[model samples]
Each structure stands twice: as C-alpha cells, then as structure tokens.
Target: MSVKIEKAYILKSFVINESDRVISVLNEKGEKISLVAKGGNRLKSRFQGKLEPFSFVKVEYFDRGKGGLNSLNNVELLENLQKWIKGDMKKFFALSFLNEVTDRFVYEKERNSKIFRLIKHVIDSLKDGVDLKLAISYFSIWMLKLSGVLSEFNEEIQCLNEILAKPLDKLDCKEPQTIFNFGLDLISKNSDKPLSSADMLKNLI
Candidate 1:
C-alpha cells in the first residue's frame, strides 16, 4: 500500500505480453530488484526510452510485501549511457558482461554500496575513452575483492591499493591483464563457474 522511491541502474529488461515490461535493476546500494512496468512497451508510455538497460534512473514503486512483483509507478532518468553503448561494440559487450555478472553476484535486497560505486566508476571510465581492456580488468579485480575471493598479490599490492583509492582518470596501469587474470582465478575458485563473459572477452583480446 505504501510506495518507495529508489535510485537504480537498469540491468536487464524485456517485454512481457504486449504492453508491459519486466525489468531487473541494481539499486544504489547494490541490491537487485525486479519491477513490472505496466504499459511500458506502449508508445507514449511514461517509461518509454527511459528504462533502457544500463541507464540510471529514480524509480517509484509499490512493494507487494509478500514476495510478489513490485508495481512500477514512475521512472525519472538520472543518466543515459547510450554514448558508450553505441560507440563501440567491444565496450558494449564488456559492459554487458559486467552488468550480467553483477546481477548474478549481488543478492536481492542485499546492500553493498561499495560495489555500486565501483560499477559506476568503471562505466564512467569506459565512457571517457579509457582503454576497454583496462577498465574491464579493473572492474574484475574490484569485483574479486568485493566477493572476498581475491587471492594475495603481494607484488602488485601497492598498485592495487592505489587503484582502489584513486579515481579512474588518475590511474596508470600498464598491464591490466595480470590483474584481470588474478580476478579470473578468484572467480573460478568462488563461483559456481567462471562467468560466461570471460570467454567472450578472451576472444576480443
């Protein structure tokens, strides 16, 4: 009966029936939530062009509170990531991969603000023309640490720490592959299996 407002990033969305859409999003605190956007697919719908995946928006919804799907009432766009999505296919894939893996790792209603900020940072770097490999690699390493699966990297601890502390524009990492592989190993050791995106990324490099 009560409505809640949340800032979220659209991760995945698809049409259901003819006029509605089912959307999955990561809230500001890195919690996953599902919403049913009534009539979202119709022309002139309030949610049109605003719920595109990877975009950031403020959403208002009514929680059913019994494990039922939330009723999405309104969406307000906060950021549009279309520049990155349309600029390079490779970068798009990498971002998509990151989004998918994030959805997989972050549990529903679980808050992890650090991870949310990290994701935004990586996406910002990609949009700023930072090397895709480097950005993706950076994302993977942080993800590893967030998941508590990263192995010790004594030699690169300083660089890793610097990366963790500094903004993307300030970073200067020459060999992102090393960090990337370290992260891959961590994921392999922790998850049910390596993320499918790993293989697709390998082909790109």
Candidate 2:
C-alpha cells in the first residue's frame, strides 16, 4: 500500500458499523475521495471530532490501489464551519444546498481546480458573513460555467456576464433572488436527480 496526504474539505461522512465510518471529501485537487476511518465512531477515537462535514483538514491515509477502501490514519483540522453555520437555520440549509450541489457535480478522481477554488472561496465568503443569496448565486453560476453548460443561458441573460466578472465576495446584484432562482433552475435541469436540499432551502427562505 502507498501513503498519501491531502488537504481536503469534508463533504460528508457515513457510519458503517459500531466503530467505523466512511468519509467523503473533496481534496485540493478537486477529486472526491472516500476513506474508511476505523474506530471513528468510538468516544475516544482519534477522528472523533475531526471528521465533521465542512471542515478543512489535512489527512493521511493508506491507498490500497483499486478494489479496496483507503484506510484513514490521521487527520489535522484546519478549519471548521459547523460552529458558524449551525446556529442559524438559513445558513445551515444554504450550506447544505451547496454541499449537495458539490457532491452531485464532482466525480471521483477527476480534478477540476476551478471548482475546488470556487468551493473554497465560497466557504471563506460564508465564514466572513457574506449574504447567503450572493454566495449561492455565485457558486451555482460558476459550477454551470465550469461544466461547460452555461453557454446555453448566456445570451438570454446579459447580467450573467457581470456576475461572472466579479469575485464571490465582491458580487452584488440588485435582484439577487431573481439571479439565484435563474441559476437554481438551470442547475436542477442539468442535474441527473433533483437536489434534496433545494426544498429545505426554499422553505427556509
């Protein structure tokens, strides 16, 4: 087995047994990786509090090549957004929507640095208290753009160009709700399955 270390954002985690967990993360390379954390569910486990979703961490794992799960060895937390987001329902559901959209669009072992940077930037913006509408709108537009399906809607909306030109933290739109809905509709249309968090976000809004 080979050892690999990567800086990644914890996308989600699943408890597989009484003492183990399966973690899904989007690494710096923009690749989605699954790692098996043994004893992760135990009270005193090394990975106990380090594997929470939306955390930025440095992880070391054993790569067993193909046909076997990667075994997690260690994790060092870099940032955790749960504390900032969990208190507010709107923030929580909005982040949930973002997480679901990222999970849906990103494929295993495929590297797309643009998407990676986009997610990182959005997360930082959210941490700094940027408007939820602007953050989601920016992420949705960029995801569609990077996926190469954005051209279909470009001619219809001139303002998309303006939005694209601005940075995530600098983005400002007079009609943020309209832009957000437009992007959301396009994202839903292109997705293979309807986003489960979409309804939750809508209700919170």
Candidate 3:
C-alpha cells in the first residue's frame, strides 16, 4: 500500500458503481495513468472539482504495480482549465478531440515529453483566445509528427515541420487545413482504433 504522488492533468473520467469513479490522466512523465476515486461522487468528497477533466492537479495515489488500478487518496488543484472551457463549445470540442486522440494513441506507461509539451501549449493557446481550428490543426500535425507517423521527406511535410519548430506563441496557424488533413490521413492509416470525438469535432467545424 505504498503511496506515490505526482503532478498530472486529468484527461477523462467515468463512474463505475455509482459511488466510485475511474480517472484517467497524463502524469508528469507523459504516461497514461488511471486512479480510482472512492466515493468521489459524494457531496463532501475531497476529490470534488479536483478530478474534473482538464484540471491540472498534484495527486497522491496507491501504487499497485502496473496491472492494478490505483486508488486516489488526495488531490491539490493547480489549474482550472474548465473555467476557460465554459460557453466555448468549439474550444471544448477541440480539446475533447485532442484528449481522445492522445488517450487512443498513447500507450500506458510510455513516455513522450514532446507530445506532452505540445498538448500543454495548445491548451494554453486555446485559453489565450488563439483560433480554435488553427490550434487543433497545428496540434494534430505536430502530434502525428512526434508520434513518427508522418513523413519528413515530403516538401510539404518539411515545411510543416519547420512551422512547428517556431515557438507556438509566435507561429501563425492560419488556414492549417492542409496539414490537418495530412495528419488525419496518417492517423487513419496507422491506427485502427477510432477517435470517439472525431465526428463531433467535424460537426462543430
């Protein structure tokens, strides 16, 4: 019953037996981790608001080896990204799509700091009023590139890679559909698993 503490971003959550919930998160190592929050739905639960998706938190959980689901013990809120998501359906959908994509493509216990940094940058950009479609497209391309699924030899791909090299805050992502489409095509061909939020994102745009 040794406990471990780490900083992480809540990615997704689901209720299981009415009172308990399973939370999915990306830890500081950029690895997917899950924790069970007992009685997390109770009105007085310590996990209230702390386990919500998109909130960055420092969490303590029981480390039950690799195969068992860990139990959450405590959480400290770091950032409330949900505050920026409210009433912004487009931005919410875009982030949801990104989260789903990450959850689908990234395997548990694997580390990829580049993709993690890119995700953090895109989230901050969205909060700062950057274009939603542009952020999504830019993120999609870079995520694909970092995952090693996109070809770097192609002229267009090379140009797109150069664009990502710029600091995210300074890069212009205007009309990024071409790169977006290329990334999506690569994702489609490489993975058989479907992104659950993909259709919703398309309809929103």
Per TM-score, the best of the predicted structures is 2
Residue-level lDDT tens digits of model 3 in 20-115? 888999987888889999999878887887788877889999988765899999989999877887777777778787788888778888898777
Best by lDDT: 2
Clashing pairs in 1: none
Off by more than 4 A, model 2: none
Rank the candidate models, highest lDDT first: 2, 1, 3
Which candidate model has the greater lDDT, 1 or 2? 2
TM-scores, all models, native as reference:
0.86, 0.94, 0.89
For every candidate, C-alpha RMSD to the true structure in Å: 2.4, 1.4, 2.1
lDDT of 2 by residue, 1-205 (tens): 9999999988899999999999998888888889999999999998879988878999999988776889999999998888887688888777777778888898877889888798899888888878888788888998998888855675556557777898877765777787788888888888999987777766666
* Backbone clashes (count) for model 1: 0
TM-score of 3: 0.89
lDDT of each candidate versus the true structure: 0.79, 0.85, 0.77
Query: Model 3 segments beyond 4 Å from truth?
Result: 152-154, 157-159, 173-175
Worst 10 residues of 1 by lDDT: 150-159
